[model samples]
Target: MLDNFPFYLGLLIIILLLIMLANKIKVAYPVLLVLAGLAISFFPGVPVIKIDPELIFFIFLPPLLYEAAWTVSWKQMWRWRRIITSFAFIVVFVSAFSVAIVANYFIPGFSLALGFVLGAIVSPPDAVSAGAILKFVKVPKTLSSILEGESLLNDASSLIIFRFAMIAVATEQFIFYKAAISFSWMVFGGVAIGLLIGWLFMKAHKYLPTDANLDIFLSLLTPYIIYLAAEEVHSSGVLAVVSCGLLLSNNRHRFLSSKSRLQSLNVWESLCFILNGLVFMLIGLDLPEITKGLEETSLMTAIGYGVLITFVLIISRIISSYGAVIVTLIARNFITVADNRNPGYKTPFILGWTGMRGVVSLAAALSIPVYLNNGNGFPQRNLILFITFIVILLTLLIQGLTLPYFIKKIKLNDIYDPVPRHEAANHLKQELAEFVLDYLKTNYEGQTEHNPSLQHLIQKWEQHIKGIDNEIISQDHKHIYLDLIIQQRKWLINKNKEDQTLDESIIRRQMHYLDIEEEKLRYI
Candidate 1:
């Protein structure tokens, strides 16, 4: 490892600002940062910095996965367990085996074992990529949940397969029965370690009285605990990280105090952004190193190979999704009153197309062992990395850019409107507001004939309710009034006025309480 602190620091600062701009411009931050990094490579007097792939996986991935898992709802995730399991377990293994078939047939000098290795790495979708792109899209909750859950769980399955694949490649030995037994041990051992560690962590939090900073620090440590525990047992650290994230997230309400929850959220959100930026930038930077190995091959040949590999990767995913859908449908038919209905033909097709390759693919490609024994370089290492990068750029930059238009063409937009959902949510808010007002009126200290202001406020709320019932008030207009309420509350809080304008004070307090309440309302 080289220090080159000045160069690395300058690059990081530039990347941070560039990422912020990319977000405002509504472009994918990863792709943009990657492009910027690629451009940086050509600069005069730039020193090349080499990093170990092992460091990135061990140091960076756990926290990122933890952040994603923490924010997702356990109940919602559990509801989609069937589809998640199908995608994570079944889809991953199928995709790996399918890619192995294609790779063995077409790619020269690439072994079946190596093909399976590539398959394992590329099978899991990147959580960061999914989170980033899905942020701006208007997708249904079920679809979003399926994507996130799949992203989290597939990392484990992919790693498990990759482990076996690596063993076969390194030892030049392959046995289906041995591989199956090893896979079971790896997966179950990782899961058991995660559960035991998570339980211990939860119990520790109970003894450690909840404080904002303490909880935030603990939140940071939980992922590393899971990663280390799993690794100690030679299991998939990725799975352990994900499982621990889920376990801790599910118990946060019970173990972490409200203040601690807010602090932890803020901490993790900031951490995720920095980590994501660096990872994407690294992906771009590594492209130069990958391209260096392509000097011997003709440009046309390389492009042809890249295209063929990309096609195989893309097709494997699409075929696997369709297969999973058919199997799930058949399984559902046997159950009485099973609610796991398939989306209309169009939705599954749309989902199949949205399976874009990204960071996981890039990382896996680069992770290909560069040296084996007897002075021979890792077989097809550079080629694997090159093809993987090409596939990621094509899927993420090309298909990702076109996804919104595809959705529009297929009328997926009409199927996934936020407006109606927001309207229903607004109705719930109004009802809650009324409930609070009623409770205060019945139980509060102030009830007087002298207070004309109090009576006017009550009359205003009743009239508002009447207007809502009569369809005289629009949800959009009510949203505007809520904005005014927020502004008024902010002004009062800034002025440190607890008792100014009695009705407004009560309203402001209610708004403050609701602000706290809505912390639990996290969703796309």
Candidate 2:
């Protein structure tokens, strides 16, 4: 390998450029990045960049999962939990099992266990990949929520299957009863440990004399600590991180200050952005190495197998998605369900079509032990890598590219909201605003009369309540506020330029607050 610093620096620059191009052309960044990486690998003197399996599992997986678990709307997740869990756990199992059956039956000289290894590697869709692509497509809120919720759990479940399959491969034995017990322990125990850790961290944040940066730093540390502890106990580290994130996310306001919460969002955003970029580019960079690993299988033959497996995964997921919807329809009658109305077929179709393989699959393929306990080479390791790469390539190119068109074609109905969300949101805003205004007017009449700021706030809310439904008026009002914000920003920039005496920290703090105000406007 070349000097690590320059290689990564160059790769980072390429990723940024490719992302810009992706945005300009309305293509997913991962698609362009993959192609860019593939093209770069062929250039003379370019080093083949191989991501360490441990690095992906340890360094990359935890925080991304934690952040997603935390930031996603908990209400939405719970609303779709049944659908999500089925896709996350049951669908993955069925896909992996289906893949195993197909691989063992069709591929020559492969054991049931080896087939399962390949199955597990490719079973779960990559959350990162799905998310990146989903950004470009307009999906129903219900569809998006279900996909997001599934991603949080599927990673853990698929990896668990991977673990069991690997053990079966290594020992040439798998006892279902023992494996079931182990699986239960891994799931139940990991979640318990995560909840316990989250409680401890919650207490620490509440009691410790930690400032905003320290709070953000502790948040960063939480995921890594939870992941390591669970993995050390041979439990599901992925599940542990996820559970811990959920617990902390829901309870953060109880422990962290407002300033800490705001700052941590920016920190996590930037960190996750860099990580997503590097992983997408790195997925492309590993092409040369993966191709070189093939010995017994021809490139075309392995690709054929990959294409076959990709088809299997697609068909299985589609079938299982529909199955989940059907099962949910039946189950809701007997048990309480989040939404009992028929979800219709289009959303399920979208859910099924979006299972693109990504960097995680590549890493899982690479993570397969180089040699078994018997000291012989792992069966078809290079072939597995090739097939994984092919599956990733096909799915990214196929589903990732075609998703937007399909979404437009399908035009799935928005089941979550009967009324337009914009209308509902504004209606809710009016109620909340009116509630606050009444409280202030009732309790702080003297302050409202005496304080100019309080009087202005009351007047503004009164005006807003009157104009909230009038889009043209509200738009103009928003623009006025935004334009003034811009003037203040420009003045600050000029002031900073003109003077060297003011502390940069204070200037930056003001700038951050302005950003929050702007974001709040856009969100509303």
Candidate 3:
């Protein structure tokens, strides 16, 4: 494999080309990458790609989860906490059991435990796939938030189930109480460790001597450190990375320099794309190997099983989604819910239809130990891998292709936020401008008399408040501008917490601009 570095490099070149082609053709790149890899795998002399489970779990999963945590709004996550948790924990558990029952009954020699192993591998919808497809279709903010938030945590829950199932299969026993206790510890313990580490890192960033480069390096190191710490204690590493990432993200302004924050974002964005792209391409490339590994079941039979289970996943998720709606409607009767009225079925159905599987399933399917603890080969390992591949390929194609249609046909009017996104953004800016103007006038009215830059900032805010061009400048007057930015940020932060209607993301965007402005004022 080391000697084949050039070949691997060439393959990546081809993968990037195919991705570009996918964009031009208006098809999702994951689908095309799979198709391209499949075609490449069949070519003479092309090595059958093998996935290293450790590589996927450690190298890939943590950073991806961390980036997602940074992007997702904490406020939104809290608002839709019930729905997100149900989908992440409840729906994943149900979906896994649904597959387990179906596989155990239908697949020859497949035990319920082994069935659960397969179920856990494939149950959680891949974050990469959902994010890719969501952009293609316009959906309600709440629905997208639910899906994104679910994807972040579902991986952790599914992996937990996968671990337990592997243990059950190895030991030929299932201890319900012990497993339940372990699950609790993993979830809560992971979060606790994450918060602890997050606080430490936050303080380090604030007090430690660090520039943009060092900050970016620490940002990269953060998820891996948190993940390793949590997993070392037999807790959920995925949750740890997520929780820590969210903590850092929320408090970024407190610590990270504006340049560091922006640079870190760009670096993570590129890294995520490369990692996800490589796996998607590898999915296509690994098919021939996964296909050839099957000895217990015929390729056609395995594919048939894959198709059957894929449908099962779809149906179960749809039912669970509707079930969630029903439960939400009922629970709202006794408890406080955002909307008590019978929340209709369209949104729930859309959520249900979006249960596509991807890279994690591929990695988990391959992660199955080739030989069990007793030395005999793992049963139906090839079949599992093949089915997982089929599920990924089929889901990416079927759901990915059809999601736009479903969204279009459903005619979803699920408007959780009455304020349009653009309008909300504009309103936020107006309020900020007004506040800044007041703050400047109140604190430094006479101080700006000799300072042209500060005066310019004040005048710009006044014109911006009047709906004129809002271009504002602040080059010199470093101390004055910095102080003013700090004051405005404090007000904006307080204002955001006070008004629930204003989108947190809009606040973040404004916060981001302030970061840039402050960075310039301080350094340049």
Candidate 4:
């Protein structure tokens, strides 16, 4: 581990730069980065990098899961909560069972337990692929929300199911009732543990003196804490990390000071970016091991199974998505609890096409036990890995590459609202005005008897506020342009504060000057 650190660092830098360039071209960074890594692996002198499969799941998964959970807007997720819940819980079970049945029938030697393991491996939709695929593939905003929300939660569910199957295989005993009870405890226990930890950390932060560096250090520790705490109780660590991340993110202003906020944002963003880059690069680099697996099985047989399973994987998802949407609509029609707001046919179709397999699938496949009977190895491990590789490659290359075009053809992209620039500008103005008024009232009251100059300044600021207010209301037609002037004034206030060459009074004076200039610009 010590000696290989330098090689991993070099790989990280190369992959980060590649992803940065990929972002510029508006291609999905992960897809392009993985493809780039795959291309690079064929070159001479590239070290054959093979990571421990379990390491990827336990080490890499927590932060990636946390990042996705952190960035997902709670308000947006709440808007389609029911659909997300259904997809996460219901769709996961359906996919797993569907895959198990198909795999059992096709693979002569594959046991139902092993088939279920494959199902669990592929059941959770890839969060990385969802973000990457959605970048170019425009879908209805609500549909995209559902997909993202499902991806986030389904990871936890499928992981629980996967572990259960692994244990069942090891013990040569499968009990449906026992598994169901254990799964429930795993999920609830994970969530309860996460919330408990999050609360403790939040309370601890209140006593700590405000420091951006220290706050970031605390933020860095959160996911690891969540993972460890949940795992100790035989629960899903991924879900725990995700839950903690979500709780902290939603209550960001409560637990984190502005300085801490900036630091935490920077730390997590950089951490997630590097982690995402490494995962994708590793995906590409794993192709050599996959090719080696084909040596055991005949080339033609390997190709046939790969192609067949890939089809099953793709078609299963599409059918499930379509089924989900239609069922949801039909149920809503009967219940009348709310409007159908069916994002229409195109939204579901785009979703069906966009269920591309990625990092999680590969990680799960690699983690499959190589040895089952102590020293005796598990049968068909190579074939399993090969099939996993084929499925991932086909979905990524065939579906991911072409999903954007299909989305365009179907015209499901119109639901998204452009950024509310005008509202943001207006909001900034209101905040600035409020700030100036409060400062003038408090300072002028204190200084009026002693300082004549301060009194004059207070009177002038009151008039300035009124004039700006009138200008905003008078030019309704040009509110967008007027708001821009207010936006610039807000920026100047922030700049003056940053410069710190002036005291609060001096900054207020400068702000007044900017406000007047803004008013004149609004008129022009």
Per-residue alpha-carbon lDDT of candidate 2 for residues 158-234, written as tens digits (9 for 90 to 100):
88999999998898889999999999989998999899998999999999999989999999999999999999999
Show model 4 residue runs off by greater than 4 Å: 1-9, 136-140, 334-339, 373-376, 413-524
What lDDT tens digits, residue by residue, belong to model 3 across residues 1-524? 78889889998898789878867766677888888888989899887688888888899899999999999988888888999999999999999999999999999989999999999999999888778777677776777878889999999999999999999999999999999999999999999999999899999899999999999998889999999999999999999999998899888888987789878878999999898899888888888788888876777888899999999999999999999888998898799975554547788888998887888999989999999989999988999999899889888999888887888888654446555788888887888788878888888878788877777878878898888865456555667667778887898889878876567878888888887776666556
Candidate 1 has its poorest 10 consecutive residues by lDDT at: 499-508
Model 3: residues >4 Å from true position, as ranges? 448-455, 470-476, 522-524
Which candidate wins on lDDT? 3
Residues forming the 10-long window of minimal summed lDDT in candidate 4: 499-508
Evaluate all candidate structures by whole-model CA lDDT and list the values in order: 0.69, 0.82, 0.86, 0.71
> Which candidate model has the greater lDDT, 1 or 3?
3
For residues 1-524, what per-residue lDDT tens digits would candidate 4 score against the true structure?
A: 67768877888788878777867776677677778778878988777867577667777888788777877755557656777887787778787888788888998677888788888887776778768767765455556667777888988888777888788778779888988888888888888888889888887776767477877877778788889889888988877887787787766646665456555667888887778888888888878867776656797787788788778777877787788878888788667522355566766677677667777877877887778866667767788787777777777778777776776777644443232434434444455565655655664466567765555545544555554433322233244334444554555556444643222223334444554554465356
* True-structure RMSD for candidate 2: 9.2
**Per-residue lDDT tens digits of candidate 1, residues 1-524?**
25688888898898889978877877667768777877887787777645467657778888988887776655556666777888888888887887788888887877999989878877776667666776666666657767888888888888788878888888899899988787887788877788788888888787867567877777788888789878887887877777778898766545765556666667888898888888878777776677888756665677777777667766777777777777778877786322454455667665666666766667666677778764667787777777777777767776566666666577554544333555544554465546535643664326525555455545555664554332132332344334434443444343333422122223334444544533432320
Q: Which candidate, 1 or 3, has the higher TM-score? A: 3
After superposition, the stretches of candidate 2 with alpha carbons farther than 4 Å from their true spots are: 1-4, 446-454, 468-524
Task: Report the CA-based lDDT of candidate 1 relative to the real structure.
Answer: 0.69
Residue range with the least summed lDDT across 10 consecutive positions in model 3? 411-420
Residue-pair clashes, model 3? 0
True-vs-predicted CA distance for residue 305, candidate 2, Å: 0.6
